[model samples]
Target: MESPSKGYLDVGHLELGGTIQSHSSKFIPSDKAEFNRNMLSRNKIISVCLLLLVITLSGCSRINSAQGWSGILVDDDRLILASMDGHIMVLDKNTGKHMWEPDLMRVKEKDEKKRAAYGLPAVSNGILFVGVYSGKIQAVEVDTGRTVETEV
Candidate 1:
């Protein structure tokens, strides 16, 4: 008779009493344990790499927050305020009504530009010298919200 292969269950010796009487060489128990340990180490390394990737990508994303407060200037009866988004608005100090505002939407239509003002507005004669963050000085009329010139 020929011998059976190693690590194979012999079905002929299997009994209904849950006892297995067979001449079979058992499988490599130590090698199977080593393979399981290697797989666990690889799984741990992959998990750590994915966690680091998520943390690195989180800092690269942008979240919408409030813009900084601009320097407020009071000119006569009108309150000259520069918004953080780069629009200049003049309001009456008495009734808190909007006196004049620059047409930023129309200006954006002509040239797509982002305006940010952080410094104080300098008033000379009737013109206000506003320093924009884009390294430009905006000369606006104090009474009529007319833009005199933008010196780059």
Candidate 2:
């Protein structure tokens, strides 16, 4: 009768009941390089797409004619407000008709600057007072689109 220890091989306290099987340990270096290249290419494409999305969104924000952080004011039948393009647009509250649009920058012949109006317009006695980002305050008459005063 043969001893049980003679039939099994002991490897680090683990006994192998059967013969050890061997697998190919060969590695293709080109496959690894190709995988790395594919990963880098994918990362670059994602980066370019993100950059393009950001640029497109930024451009869209600027392209809009009525962009601003100011709040809207409804007085009587009109909706008075200031826009990011430094323009005052008064529209009909019910019909949404354009009553007037007074572009202060255009009146100053500085339309190229495209200043923003961050403050809400104050309406009192049928007059609208708006403060622009360029440190200018404009007083406009609600009855007409005419600017009453522009203080720089």
Candidate 3:
């Protein structure tokens, strides 16, 4: 303890000297030194885990054919068109191309940064339910292209 009166004495098995005395060295296990040396590097462990996660996600996103593409409408059991890019594009009943003016563009441009239309065009009964930017959801008539319901 470097006491002026004690003369740095080792009163018991404890060496009363140096910085080691200030720390709780008695709590350390005998094998911790060897165990720490063998542990894998933190950076390497994180990198390997991230690589595996990316590979798994990419595999899930891969579509064998255009059959599963979002916004694609199927009529008479045939592919119509693929609607993507934050717009409800009218696809030819065969060629998956924009048929009507992209639904979003037709609405006057508002937000400078156009958000992606993540909504899957739903055609049921005859109405289509589509999601727009900023949590805007609308049900449009498939034939007339008029909004039947608007919910933001």
lDDT for each of the candidates? 0.69, 0.66, 0.51
Instruction: Provide backbone clash counts, one per model.
Output: 0, 0, 3
lDDT, candidate 3, equals 0.51
Sort by lDDT, top down from the best: 1, 2, 3
- lDDT string for model 3 (42-93, tens) is 6678889999999878876636523233455565433333233344545456
lDDT of 1 by residue, 1-152 (tens): 24567555444554557765565655556777799999999999999999999987875554554555478788788777776667777779898888765433111112324476668877889997777666667787788878786554
lDDT of 1 at 5: 76
For residues 1-152, what per-residue lDDT tens digits would candidate 2 score against the true structure? Answer: 22225334323332368644433333446767799999999999999999999987887564554455577888889887777666677888999878764323232326536456666778888777777666767777877877686454
Q: What would the TM-scores of all predictions be? A: 0.50, 0.49, 0.40
Candidate closer to the true structure by lDDT (higher is better), 2 or 3: 2
User: Could you tell me which residue pairs clash in candidate 2?
Assistant: none
Best by lDDT: 1
